[model samples]
Target: MTDSNMNSHELELLIAAWLDGRLDDEGSHALQNALRTSRAARETFRQYARLDAALHDVADTSAMLDLTKLAAACVRPSSAEQSPTRAQESSDTEGSKTERRQRPFMQQMAKGSRVKPTSRKPIASLRMTPWYAALAVGILLVAFLIRGFSVDEPGTESIADLSPSEKTINTDAFSKVSLSKPPAPVAVLSSVEGVIWADSQLEVGHAFFEGESIRLEQGEARVSVGFGAEIVADAPCSLKFLSSDRIQLHDGEIAVDVAPWAAGFTVVTEEMDVVDLGTTFTVSVEAGEKAETTVLRGVVRVHPTKIEGEPRRGLLVSEGQRMSSDGKGSFVNVPQDQDEVQKQLGRLDFGVTGPYRPVDLSNTGQGLSTGDEDLHWQVVAGPAGVFSEPQYASVCEPERGYLPNDPDVSQWISTADWRTALPNAVYTFRTEFALDGYDLATMQLFGRFLADNGIESVRVNGNPVEVQSWVDNVKYQAFGDLQFRFVNITGGLVSGRNVVEIDVRNGMMRTGHVKDPPLSPIPNPMALRVEWYAFGRQQGIAQADDGVRLWRRIRDSVPPMSMLSYAGPEI
Candidate 1:
């Protein structure tokens, strides 16, 4: 390539990089130099950046527009399409002046709406010179190529599948843009278990941002997006962060709960757009397939994106309704049984293999003894357990699920000093239990923990395993009886003795955030108690035979207290 051609190609690459926020410090400096030296570079940068900003802040109805449509809308029509008459030319000129007049007002409106502004210098004018027209067409064409748009392709073509010639041309043309760097996080990783695959390794405290692609190779993550949306994405899936309120699921399944403040949360797929209607829902998509949207609560709007006709329509999917589309873009709706849907989705299925008997591992040295209160105290008391004594007069009592079927199991242990010291603390309670061999098919482990907002995970034989919250209504009962379930750990178990460690992290106290009750002398301690049951894989667990597990059948039944819990704040 000639020097001028090489410079032009480099400028296009830099402009593309700047538009995607993928430009490094060096590339950014180069981009600035090109903008100063080349008017075409400046125009191209402004055009791409503005279109990107518009798409990023698009409203509910218009969000489904793809990059090609957005680019076409942004670029001015060719000169051949322009008016030939003098009056028409004057009208076009006047329209251009009107657009220039509205530009500042548009910027002000974006600012007032609290949307982040585009990182671009002000455009000189909306006037369309022949040079600008040619530059606009080049910018739009490069935008389509860089954004993964393909022509004369068979079926769906991934970015990785570009032909060598196409790849070489695009690579040299847009070499400045780095597709690997993760964007600044608009959310925090609140809870994570298993393995996550992305361009970068992620941790619980790590932050993620819009436009970042995250894949769950194995495991699960519950990310808190902003303050109001909680996203639970299961592994073996691909997800792209479109914005704080929207994500695109290329594959796998994700469940999202949106608070009222963050209404209109959306999940995008190739075939459809699943928009939240102030509700909780799950969206699933697989390669070469349509997206399945299941509404667990509230409502969702499933809009077809790749329909053949213009003005594509959407259907409302209410709670207990399921909406799905085929690869050919045909959408279907059907009434679904919530329980059956949960089972199919693997929401409530544990996939446990065998039978179980309660095993106790407490500091008091009890081995499944039926009537021991002090031994229970050793498990429930101390620095990491609940407050030694009840701190408040409320209908809430300590979770007695792990206690023996005896009245004396309710003995109070004493408050530890650390109860009031740690605001958001993580406390782990471990139990080393013996197992003869890996003969059992499945093991169901249950444990209790106290926290305002907490999730638990288990390490069996020093390897982290998936643990689900046993209590269904966890959000409503923040301080109520909460338990964690480690279901079907047959794979993690070994032939010899195994150790299970449970880590529970507590949330901030209510006194600081939402004042609802009187202050107590001491805060509740982060307590944990664990029990396990196992059976042979061949025999399979029986639902009616409740004696194998005491708490499984009656999880919702409140403790048969000779005393009603005192009615007040249970802090």
Candidate 2:
């Protein structure tokens, strides 16, 4: 009889989407039933609905003050006095019922003389006199005109005066606003506890937004966004706050749990500005460059301007699907390996298929010939498909395919110095290899790439660090003469020099594109937490033949992580 619910944001969203426009529909009925039946959920639903209406109203009317005064009466006190019930404030309360009586949607919703949601009918009609209503409508028109939107950038809309006593949708305002140049910088949006400040002190001359994610201009932040909020950051990028939970990326990657009815938000950037949206997806922006969008659950429409020519297409990604553009399409999806990362970083309680193999360098169970050169590695975990698996990261000689300096350069990087780079995760590194300047082959394996740049932290970057990477949800195949793409990021920026130094380790390469035989039996499916410091510090390889000597030392330095997925609660 009672199932008091709503443990997270996703549940709230599910209820919201179900009751969205047709507040009188079956979904609404079910949600309302759930709310009314459970006292705890009743207030919770009311609060969420209030916030939703506020955001909807803001979106519906982004004009300026004088013009804004004419917006939906919900913003004005006078109208509030005349209207009863916050329910009427909802966008669900579309056009007047006098006209709705003739509307097909209404006719279908109504069952003859006995109309459903008759109780809601009163609120929709809670109007002032015809003259005042006319004035309100006129204001609504103007509200769409000069609302607070930037006009400094190219392609933006303009607002005109309102004459009061009109009931027009003023669709033209959308076009103007959509086509006009970007509005001048107003106060950055502060929603759901997310704020950004890029003032004089912060001289971040270059900031880009491609798919759906946020890139900081300068200062740090403490943000808390709803689930499925996407954002990206280009190279020359670093986000070290007290905590980075609930944040998305436009150029890099992030994972979020966007509950069904809950809203999904994305931050897309190109090189100078950041755009925000609500949807389920991941955003990748080239470091300081382009943007890409990948949709997992909902649609994410992005644009520097939502008008014609300036770019009108948006990536419409859905379940098992993806859409992209040259930094155009706007959709969202959680990034790869996000769940596993969360487990390792946040120490979250998670699940995994067994055969719990540890990630020690020791080759115990794995039968590897002593001093075996020429190794191979591959990633295999999809047919059963449990979590978001990362692609195989490969590392090898920098041959003609990926370098320009020397194809014979060995020990691409000073392993002795890798510990000095101080990576940001167990995943960031830079090794040195001799690669000649040549074009990439028609085929190239690309996915998630990480490195430990001779330090305590690891760097995580995916293939094809461009906006399209996020939009397409795949690595870009390059066909260029050998050069280096050393840094791979979710935001999609390739900086530094020759890329041969950071080739994927065996585990990092994809199995489907297994060009090399696996070096040895894939030891642990789990991501490793190397005591890079101790190991690299001693310049000692944990040789399998070193018997228990190496395993014991390696085991003591770090705890075992899930070999299945490379991310999860921090150990």
Candidate 3:
């Protein structure tokens, strides 16, 4: 019968026949079509296959005798060497005497006599005996009894009597007899920085279950949902874990970093659902106002929630784009502020306490030292053009304004005494750092520096950066008048090793004096003070590339007796 016309009873019979190797070609075709088109049919087939296997196991273990050999032995016995008529003729006189002499045991058994053998005989030689036949009957009986006890009872309804759906229910129940179910955690709290939960106390490495709500009162928290998706939730935020790949942002802001394999990671808000199309993005909810989404890298699709009777289509927001949506289904493009977004990304405080220390370019407080065997800062160029021998800058106290001092966090360093340095001459100082185990794409390198006598230019890894120097003039500024120049060197940094070059120009001196000379008569005093830190998300704990971990190590390494400190930005 065709699959469409076949009833459940018919399908069950066909499956049973197939399992028993008794199905016809038509039934086999119908069963195949049913299994291909219907899930129930396939499940039934699986259950039948399992039952067939169990029956075969029972049969293999219990029935070891070869029935064909037993039948051949019974029909053609080894005693057939003499003819029946000759044996009858020999029953009297000379023939009887000959038979008695040739086959004494056979003649005695035919005369209804009980004969006892001297020794035991092999089973092959005793196959045609009455005792052997009786033993075979007993073995068959015991095998049937064992099978009857192991299988269903005599009065119970067989599988053929049950409907297809009922059969599935019974089979499923049997399969699940030894199975157990356990609740699965959807995400884990990988890192927490100054986090204060609203009600419950949570620590780092906490596992979160689906449908669980988290209310953060202060600080940043990062949750690692599987599939390489991580969510960093800023304080005053409330969120719910919907699943491993999705979360609902009730309030506050959260930045999501989706690895390539986690493209469908989604952030749900009241206004819209921000689905990652393989990107890094931030989603924020303004209570009842609107939801804003900013894409830092890659792309995302912002699907607005339905409002009243209106259905809205999703908007594609690419890298460096920001979009905001009102709960009423209105979408507007907002100007993207990448720097602010980057600062938010930087705030992810992975509490990595590590073996890799932060790169220090300062003159004091674990900064560039003169007595160290491995020096970081070297004077590459001076008044003599190029130094034949490597010249290392020595830490020195500044004669003028707030130059880094021994008591401060960073100290000033110069190649020679400022008084002896040539006027109008430029000195280039270079420092090298290695980012051995960091993820280069997400690394953030930023710091500040102060220079005396003015800095002309700054280059990172031989590439120029658009950084404004704190002082550009050769003239001296008043004490406490020096300002620190902030530099973000992320764009110019390389993966393994990096170099930073700073060119400081000395002021021109004047000969004869007046009240205020056009240039200072005394020789120009040149010194440089630098304090910078490099940060990045480390790939592993042992690699020493975790920015926060390295930062903490460098900060904590400072002596307690000293007044210097290396505190990072507050969350």
Candidate 4:
């Protein structure tokens, strides 16, 4: 359901149903569309997958048992029917016959086909005698124990005890991994999608016996593997990673920020392998499909290793540079800010200041500008910027203070007379047009409208939420070659009650809940300074365009009303 109040976990569950073959075709396609291009969302999917796998490991140990054999074993031989002379002979053959019977049963069990079909109604099975059931369960447990199915962690439930209905718990808790679930191993099978995660190093590639070790199916994550983490795979489509890393990405687009001492970090993609040269970067790999890597810091060694073990004999990707490989023999060096590259690699087109920073935009603790301050934005600079400019390097600087919209901030700003000087990029303006008569409000919205029109995911509270992409979330016409995603609402801006912030999505989710609603313009969280009229390209410009010519047109042609602006020196 695409309800407005749907949380991240709910949305992730929707995705899980689609991945688990529980949803209808229309729902499945809709879920895919809902998940397209969201790296964090994809990472979330992987987390759900991991969680699902972990719980499954605890619940579905039935395959390990030969239920048909168990059913047969329940029928024991008659002890009274044997004579003393015959008993000795029978006893002699007993052990050997048991082993012989077990041999065929074990073979069938190994093939995963000998397990009797679970009754149509599980309740009937539940109604069976606890002694027999317990024995069957004990057999399953022994089999699992022989299989070494003991979880290193405790109280996480035993796989043998899991009823099929309890499976939803794992899928439900995937997107938002809280402290509720204790530390445990989450494994994914070849058939399972979006159900795994790797928060730390993988000492051996043996972790994934049948399928992917950790599938970054949806959402985003920050993974820091020590030198010990070594990931390797055989089948192509099984392994995946969304772009959640701070530097080198394994599956989806991930940004890696390696500590200076870090070493031996390698991110493999369908196309090529971008090894970490003790640098920070983001690489994205999708669905055993396409892949792209962008280096934000340090360096990445890119070579033509179309196939594993073939020397990665390509070129080096330097800092602030990028490359694209799709596992094909050829790899292309993709330049920075390339729209096609960003779109394909699942990077957003909006201005994302890496990590959320609120104070950089305000100080008085009052709301950023016009509307609610809860809808904060995070921008990651693709390339370096100029002097005194809001460049990537500058934004990455330490003096920027705590993340602006971070949950740590206790005081939320009100929409009264509060203002502060921010970087030009955060507060750029034009006298051309305003949203209704609200110059400041419209100016704040300019950033949002522009950001929403050109990106994949955007943040509306601190958490990164989903929205329609730039192309799909638009209402525009040829207004002198300048295209705009106009929001035709008015009342929201006046009282700052209807303030909205668009989610410029950088990636999509693979599992959990899946939904997409129309991209309606929300009220501006903060206001900007600039006087002008609001203009729509003959395409429903709801607000006024109090005809005034300025150097440039404010972003969305929606300027804040002049009714309530602050006077200099604190109100």
Candidate 5:
């Protein structure tokens, strides 16, 4: 029936048909149109959808009633059934002929059966009594209450709600103690991916209460427990929430970062308990194996939970220490393996600056130059002095003010003019340095490329490095923002006179947005200059007194840019 002609009862019947997957295309189209036009219709549909889900859950859980038998009982005819009419008999005869034509083998097999066959059509229609109808409504109401189902107004759905088709109950929301435990939320899932549970359904931004457990069958999750403590858990793990400050890791690996406020945070493994004393640590527990705890920062106290009659002494593990436990909960201090330690620490940028020397090519009296700011050519440091003398470049361009592109790429020019500089072409910044007895195998080149939406393709002694790894985001102005990368120059380094070439695809003439018209090279001038460039043995680089020590100081880390960055998809 058309939506305009569908009465309230007809709409409800259509909903039931839709729930039962019996609604035809035309009826479904009409229902969708009605939902768009009427708010009440949408609400009613949501209520019925939730009701259907609850009914399925009930059917799966309850053993007292067989749903298939109940369906048969509803359609079964009583002894008062009337005989088939002549027209009905003719229809049945036609249906039998059609079935035979469709499947002759099945018809032949059925014809040989000893048991008498019943017609596909029922002998009589069963009418529902008022009591039966009322009982169904009462059951639906009770189910809705038990499921805590409610119809939300338009545009009120939570951001974390995925889709109704994949709906799984959020056990965290239940207050019924057996199914849902703990009175308050102890943690919140900050982010999650490919995560499904063996025990309960979990979602991002959902508050997790204590006494609840989550099994990470696969995927990863970053959970924030207590004040500032965040736990990044990988797949094949199970975690039981004990309290705001404590949890039991039944299996798998988890990296926990506890702030000062959450100093007493604890993670319980099968072997022992790892108590965080304002630290960042990783606890890995394998089934039937000893639990390993690695302290990334600060300190932790590992205590044996399954000790004998005597009191188990808590072992204080300081920073850079690793403790391995025996299956029976005896933790022994073991030498920390750097490679193994890095794996447990995840994406830490460890300190690497050391045993090498650096030569500054972009300095005064040094070989830094340019032919013409307007010309598109490389200004190599050589004879004839066509390349400009090296001068200090400033990130704070007070005189020139802000160059408009994206607000994030705003920079200052300490010496050169911010505008009317660098033509819309590749500007090669070449620098040469000498090397001696220093170990080139352990050495790496690290520096920033300062240009507005520019800087592409880097080559060392004619060998090309992976631009994706060196350049953080090529589609945007990152190297221009003083962001440095520890470039791996494998086979690019030699004994002396090593040539490092950097190609700059200056985005002076083009608008960052793809939709806008491209500007001509004359009017669109971009400011370009390298703030700093340095190369030496990896050990010669300076180390900062903080976090994971790395070879170079990364200025400003930014996310990667996309190639198909149009206004919308399919454009």
Candidate 6:
């Protein structure tokens, strides 16, 4: 039949026959015509191919083919097309034969259906042309018979020996098999800081699909690509995730850290393409004006967009090197601004840093564990007047001294000296700090403290923060020097003013008597020495003025064409 005259049902049958290597030349031509002219027919063919492929993986290859019954089912006239007479009676018989042939073979085989010998020839004897042979071996196997088959081995029961119920085929299995591809996530929005998207709303942990585009309006966001790469895009940036290892940056700045396994991760721009070579790099595009590529670590291949009739060229940018596009399909070397590179690098490295300052402690409070009226730190819940200077004796051994004066951290402040704070008591120290013009979602507080005895618990903004060492009952006593206990603060931090409360607990002396304790038993100090290692935003969002200045610098510093090197096309 011609493609125009073939209905969907007929086309499906032809597809099945084609998959089974049973389609005649006329049917093949018609099927090809239908597939070419009708998208629905092509989709149906694909579904059948998928179903056939799945069946090939699980279907028993040794099963016998019931060619006569299948052909009869395909050619039999429907009851609606015939009258209730002798011809109708023959049609009813044919209908019953078709019904029997449609039953699932496994169900009938399990039910021990009767079997009878068939005069039909075995599949090995059927003549297959080269086209049919190729179709059977390369494209689709004859899995259409999975639901309708018989055993043809010698000394074994034939399908004829099975009961009538076993003779039916289960064509429903074809309709049940799924053919569509599953959704794949190419990346995840791992972190968001004061972000405003131009279109749809997205939260942290949102999965990104291929070809998904995002516009960062006001803040920064980080995406963890599936293939071992990460992207940190600053505000006013637009990008499209092309795949796990590639993306298209339309405008603004983005830092990409490609793991070793994802060495070829590429960032496409309007004027160039930056291909990573196991490195961390930054790509900035000024929307139709210019594009810059800076390699922070390792190396990257910077390919300027090819201009028609011009030879393709790329530059290998090593660490501490920067390249810029002239907005005319050419690239030039620009001064590597280490300061800007470090700033972007800081934005990518959000991990905590050391010597966290007490919210109330002044910058001059380093080394001392005791808080005075000048400091905002106050005893809110525990005994007062226990604060004292930290003094470690030789018996205290290691962890005796305090961290030396450092600009990064504030002084250690305790309620009192360890010798006077030996009693079993809990001292809650409260301090307050204000968070302004900062991205609260990206803020993280990390620090280590040296207490006389141990820390009971810690709370931020009145919400309890987890202290695993305390939960595990690990002691936090500082013997001599600054063996500080680590604390990570991720939640309970809010905008504006925030409160931090540290509950310092002084355990009872190991010796029963607190007074005149043996030298072996060191005196317990009730001091709390906290050093703010790193707090708040490790890296601030790229300012608009900075971006403008960057483009201006690139424009001013563009070297003469003679000074630029054009390496041949990337291999």
Estimate the Cα RMSD of every predicted model relative to the unseen true structure: 27.0, 30.5, 36.2, 28.7, 26.3, 28.9
lDDT tens per residue, model 1, 341-397: 666445622123222222333432223232223323322212344334423111112
**Tens-digit lDDT string for candidate 2 (216-279):** 5532332222121222222323322111122223344332223233343334243212222333
In model 5, the runs with Cα more than 4 Å from the true position are: 1-182, 199-201, 339-571
Model 1 segments more than 4 A misplaced: 1-184, 196-199, 341-571
Residue lDDT tens for model 4, 167-264:
11121234422111111111111112233444432321111211123434333333222121212221222243221121223354445444443344
Could you tell me every candidate's TM-score relative to the true structure?
Answer: 0.31, 0.19, 0.33, 0.23, 0.30, 0.33
lDDT per model, in order? 0.47, 0.27, 0.57, 0.32, 0.50, 0.54
Cand. 1 TM to true fold: 0.31
- Runs of candidate 3 with Cα error greater than 4 angstroms are 1-182, 308-312, 346-571
Please give the lDDT score at residue 559 for candidate 1: 22
What is the C-alpha lDDT profile of model 3 across 449-468, one tens digit per residue? 55655676789988987664
Q: In angstroms, give how far residue 535 of model 1 lies from its true place.
A: 47
Worst 10 residues of 1 by lDDT: 160-169
TM-score preference between candidates 4 and 6, better one: 6
Better of 5 and 6 by TM-score: 6
Better of 2 and 6 by lDDT: 6
Q: Candidate 3 or 6, higher lDDT?
A: 3
> Where does model 4 exceed 4 Å of error?
1-252, 286-289, 303-305, 308-315, 334-571
- Please give the distance, in angstroms, between residue 86's alpha carbon in candidate 5 and its true position after superposition: 73
